[model samples]
Each structure stands twice: as structure tokens, then as C-alpha cells.
Target: MSDRWQEMTVFVRVADSGNLSRAARELNLSQPSVSRIIGALEARLGTTLLLRTTRSISLTEAGSLYLERARYLLAEMEEAEQAARGIDSLHGVVRLAMPVLYGTRAVIPALATFLPRHPELRVEIVMSDARQNLIADGVDIAIRLGVGLLDDSAFGARKLAFVERLVVAAPAYLLAFSAPDNPADLARHSCIVQHGLFGRESWRFTHDQTVTSVDVQAKLWINSAPGVLAAAVAGLGIALATRVMAGEELRTGQLIQLLQPYRLDPAEVYAVFPAGPRPSAKVRAVVDHLEVALNTPS
Candidate 1:
């Protein structure tokens, strides 16, 4: 029974990774060893689970069905072990995909506490601002910050926190002109827009129970949050930045927070995981820890 489960686990890893050599490195087995295990498992089942060539590995129809069942069964086995041994049973690699700057500046530091408590587990962070398909990327959890998860029906999500954003500029830029005293002043300034996140070159602010929206005329539109902040630090233009992304820079005076008192509505942060079956204990623990880390006072 143990051998059967290990076979399923190996099959699942290979299917997820799409490369036997990559799966071999992840599983700490040689490439030939992983190939042999897959071959032996397929022979026992009397069907080919994968279509492999010199370039890539893909699941056959039988492999697709088997992959689903294998994931479900492995998740169940982990849960059963958890019920038997509590937190000590949580051992394995958990892959987390997150935005580049937010994950590095805000989320990663917080994991310092969570990791020591689970030394048996390993966490791998895949960082990108672009959205990732969790199952296709073999990610256990993805951290997202935005207005909403409108099209993500294939995943289950937990809200972590709402992060307030700020309008900021470098000391050098302010020296050239002057800091924006109000939202309307941003319209006259050169703004560094993050096109991917906000889409429209616009900024929103609130004051005295009233809301204000301003359109920005930006010569440069950056697709990355970090890229936008980098432009601001270089005095290229003013930027709308999240506190999470600019915390260190603001503290060091590389970037100065602008437009006092008024603030943009906080963006929503989420921990998204695949939709089927209860998440493994390690996944749940990591998500829970992120909620604490992000929401905790800095």
C-alpha cells in the first residue's frame, strides 16, 4: 500500500512538472530513476499515462484522469496523517506564487516565523506580477492583490487583507516642482502608471466623506508594480504605490509619500488555491500564516 501511494505521488509530480528531469530534481531522484518508476507504474496499470518525447511530457487522457484521482487521494492521505499526528505530520514542498515586490518586501519577511515552526516542510516562492494558473504552474497557493477575483472560478480563495495605496514621489522630483497638495495636482504631474494592475491611468482618493477620482497623463505606463516604483525613485514621475511595495523606500526617504491624509481605497489581497478537494494541511497553514503576517502591524 505504501509503495502504491509512492507510485501515485511520483506520477503526480511528473505530470505536474511536465519534465521527468525537473521532477527528478524536485523529488531528489535521478532522471533515469524517475523514468523507470513511471514506466513500471504504467506497465502495472496496462496503459500509458504520459506521452513523452525529447522536448516535453504531456498527460494522455488516461493520465489526466489518473492525475486528478492521484491528487485527491494524496490530499486525503495527508489529511488522514494530520488527523493522526497533528501538525508534526505536515512535511513536503509547498509552492507559492506571488507578485514580485509585494511577496519579497511584505510577505516573505513574515514567513520567518512560520518556517521555523515547520522545519520539516520546504517553501518555494515563484515570483511574478503576471497572473499564473495554479494547477498548470504546479503552485500550491498564489497571492493576489487587486480589486476582485472576477474570472477565477477554478480556484478557492481566502481574503488576507486590504492594503492601502499611496501617491509618492522622490525628493528630487519634489525639489524640481512641489509635492501635490491634492488629488487634482497629480493630473499636472508626470505619473508613472502601472498599466497591468489599474489599467486606466487614474488615481482615486477620499476626503471628508467624499470620494475623488483623478485622471493621470503619463508618458510611461509600466506593467510591473516594482517597475513603477523604480521610476518614481529615479524622479521620472510620481507613482501610485502600495505601502507594502514602498515601505522600505519610504522609511529610507528614497521615496516620499505625497498627498497627505487622503488615500486610495485599499486593494484586496487573497490566497488562492485549486478548487477541488480540501487543501493539504501545509497549504492551509501557509495561507493562515500569510493572513497573520500581512494583517499584523508593521
Candidate 2:
């Protein structure tokens, strides 16, 4: 059975590399040992899988079909091994990436309490509004705000929360400018615009089955969502912001919601990680903890 598994591994390597010598080098085995494994596999399967030549080796028709199944079986075995190990212990540094506002307003609270429970684990949170490549950036997990899942086949993305957006301005600002009665009124009002990773000025809203857009003429363009809120608080201009971020300000009357009848759909927040069979224990724990924290009533 051990030899059979070895043969399968060798067969997979050969199929992948397209040559026995290259596969042997990758597996740290001698050329003859690699060739013998393939020979044994072909004998067991009662078929020739490779066409060897002086210049190179190519897969036979049967080998081409078998290669895909072989890869799947190997991946499953690896996942089974990881799952067995996960039941015992989970300890590692988990690198996380997310937009600044969500990281500050939502994710931080969950991580603050979660980290204390697991002393052996370290969590690194990178707060940026930019969309980062998960694999290139070495991010174990990411939290993104949007309507649909990110189109990353290489990763697993799950919706974690819905965040409502609100147009808010200080009472003084509202009194000075007179709140906009409708979306069209925003054109006459000086608005504080947010220039996030997506862009500087486009915002969408819906009211009574009718969609309206305000092309905001900005007096101030800030790079961060929090910065835009701050501008609104200081009575600079009206700001469209997430309720998750502006909730305290609205409650305190520092900011009042404008165009209350026309509200934008809350941006969907997703917890994403590299797609795989068994998510790492550390990653799973963090995800579970975050859901609990975010869902709990404040």
C-alpha cells in the first residue's frame, strides 16, 4: 500500500513535469527510483501512461485523463492530514487586510477581544482602503465592502454584514445651507466627497422605486471615509457615509441624516480567505469570533 501511494505520487509528478528526470529531481529521488514507480503504476493500472522520447516525454491519452483525478486525490489526502492536525492545536500569525473604516469601526472590536483568548496566536491587521491582492500581499483573510463577492476564484469570500450608508451633516451646517429636499438639491450644496480606493466622487441612492444620482461638486475631497465624516462634523460640507461609521455622530446630533427618504443600500462586507478544502484552524476561529462580535447587540 505504501509503495502504491509512492507510485501514485510519482505518477502525478511525472504527469505534471512531463519528464521522469525532472519529477525525480523535484521529489528528491533518484531517476531510476522515479521511473520504477511509474512503471509499477502502469503495471497496476495495466496501461501505458507516458510516451518517452529522447527530447522529452508526453502523456498518453489515458495518462491525460488520469492526471486530473490523481491531483484531486492527492489534494484530498493533504486536506485530511491537515484536518487531523487541526483537531489538536492551532497556533500561528494570521495576517489580515481590510478597508480603514470597517477595520476601525467593526473589525477592531472583534479582534481586540478575540486576541486575548488565544495568547499563542498573533493577528496583524492592515488598514487600507485599497483593494489588495490576497496571495501577493500574503493576507490570510480580508474584509471588503461591496455588492457582490470579489471575483477571486483562488479565494473563499463570504458575506459577513450589511452596512447602510447615510448622508449626514452637522446641525449648524444643515441650518446654514438648508438641508437638500431632494437629490437634485445636492448640486447646489457644497458636499464633502470621499475618494476611496474605488474613486473620488460617484455615490448611488434609491427612493420610492426611483433611482437618483447627485453629481457632487466637492469643496473637499478626502482619501479616507473617517476623514470625510470629520469634514462633515466640522460643518465643512454634507457627507455621505456609512451608518456603521457615523452612528455615534448621528446619535449625538453632531450629524443629521439628509435625504432620509432616499437611502443607499448598505455596502456588503465579506470575510474572505484563500479557497481550499479545510480552512486553517486559526483562520476559522477568527472568522467565527468576528461573526459573533459583529452580530451581538450594542
Candidate 3:
């Protein structure tokens, strides 16, 4: 009898990657082992699946037919595996990726309550704004805030909330210089631009369903949110910042909102994970617990 399940997995990986070397790397197996599996699968079927060349590999007619069925079978097997392990009680380490500000303010605080419930569970958080591959990085979950989540492959994501951005300036700065009324007016002001992970300096705004992108060069440039907030509060210049990061300052009158009619693009925060893998009890619990915690303001 053919080892159909194992063969299907190897087939699916090779087809998706379109290269033996990448499939082997992703599977954490040697190239020879991958080749052997493919050879066995072709032998059982008594036909050539992949047409190999010195420089590249191409799928034959048989390979194309096999790939579709193989993917479905592999997906079904993964679902079954998840269903079999659906119980809530679990124990293991969960690697997490989160933006720095949220990691410090929201995620860490929620973990304090969650950790008690799962005494055997451990969490290692990689706090960064840069995106990384969850599987390659060994991450169980990633707390992301931005537009790149939709484009990611092999990941499942759930939106937590909308993160709005606002342009603000300290009271002293506003008194010294006029605040911008609209996107175009920003050009006359000294803007403090934040160069985030995506190398974005331009801000997006929407008015009456019409979107406009404003590129305001900054007199002062900063990479971190905390530094930007400080600079705005110290009357350095007008800063565009996330509502969550600048909430305290805005409430206390340290900074005043600018351009009320035009609003910046809102980013959604999501808890992302590997799509095929069933989350362990620890990961599931943390995701559930934090959703409630972050949604509720303390």
C-alpha cells in the first residue's frame, strides 16, 4: 500500500513552493529526503509528476492533477488533527510577535492575568514593528497593526480593533505656529514625521469617500512613537501618531488635534497565526483573553 498521506504532504509542499530546495527548507528536511519522497510518490503512481531540469522544475500534466487533490487532502488532515486536539487544557511555550508600544502597554498587562490560568505555559514576545515570517521565526502568534496582514501567506488573522491616526501639536507649538486645517496646509508647517517599518513618510487621508495622500517633509524625523510623542509634547512640531499611543497626551491637553475634517488612514490590529496549525490551548487562551482586555479600557 502507498503511504498516501506522507506522499500528499510532500507533493503539496513541492507544488506550492515550485522548487525542491525551498520545500525541503520549509519542511525542515534534507533535499535528498524530499527527493526520495517525490520519487516514491511517482513510482507508486507509475508516472512522472514533476519534470526536472538542470535549472528548474516544472509540473507535468499528472503533477498538476495531483497537486489539487493533494492540497485538499492535506488540508482535511490538518483540520482533523486540530479537531482531535480541541480540548482547552494545554502546556507549552508560545512565541509571539507584537509592535513595541502594544507589547508594553496592552499585551504584557493582559498576560499577567492569563499566565495564572496556564501555569505551565510560557510566552516569548518579539516586540518589533518589522514583519517576520511566523513559521520561519517559530512564532505561535503575532499581534500586528497595519495593512500588510492581508497579503501574508500561510497565516490566519482576526481583527481586534481599528487604530486611528491623528495629527497633533503641543499647546505651545500651536500658539507659536498655526495648526493645519487640511492636508494641503501641512506643507507650511514643520511636521515631525515617523519613519515606520514600511519606510512611510506620507500620510493618507479620506474626505467624503475620496482619498488623498499627503507627503509632508519633516523638520524633525524620528523612528519611534514614544520619541515622536515627546517631541510633539515638547513643542518641537506637529506629529502624526496613533490614537492609542497619544491618548494620554491628548486627554491631558499636552497635545491638541489638528485637521478635524480630514482623517488619516486607520490601521487594524490583528492577532495572526499559522493558518493550518491548530492553536494550542495556551495560544487560544491568550488570544481570547487579550481580545477582551484590549477592547476594554483600564
Q: Number of the top candidate by TM-score?
A: 1
Tens digit of per-residue lDDT, candidate 2, span 4-98: 67877788767655667777876789999888888888988999999998877788999978876775676576556658866334455787888
TM value for model 1: 0.85
| Alpha-carbon RMSD to native, per candidate | 2.9, 8.2, 5.8
TM-score of each: 0.85, 0.67, 0.66
Model 3: per-residue lDDT, tens digit, 1-298?
Answer: 1478877877776765567887797678899999999999899899999998877778899998887677557556645655676634345577788877757776798788778766666788888765665554656688887644456655666677766788899999988987777888877788897655323657778989989887776899776667778899999998877777788888999999988888777767788875333454466777888788878777
Global lDDT of each candidate: 0.84, 0.76, 0.75
Error of 2 at 252 (Å): 2.0
- Ranking 1 against 3 by TM-score, winner: 1
Top lDDT prediction, candidate number: 1
Instruction: lDDT winner between 1 and 3, please give it.
Output: 1
Error of 2 at 285 (Å): 2.2
Q: Kindly report which residue pairs in candidate 3 clash with one another.
A: none
lDDT of 1 by residue, 149-237 (tens): 44577677888999988888999999997888889988888888776565567677899988999998887888888898899999998
Q: Candidate order by TM-score, highest to lowest?
A: 1, 2, 3
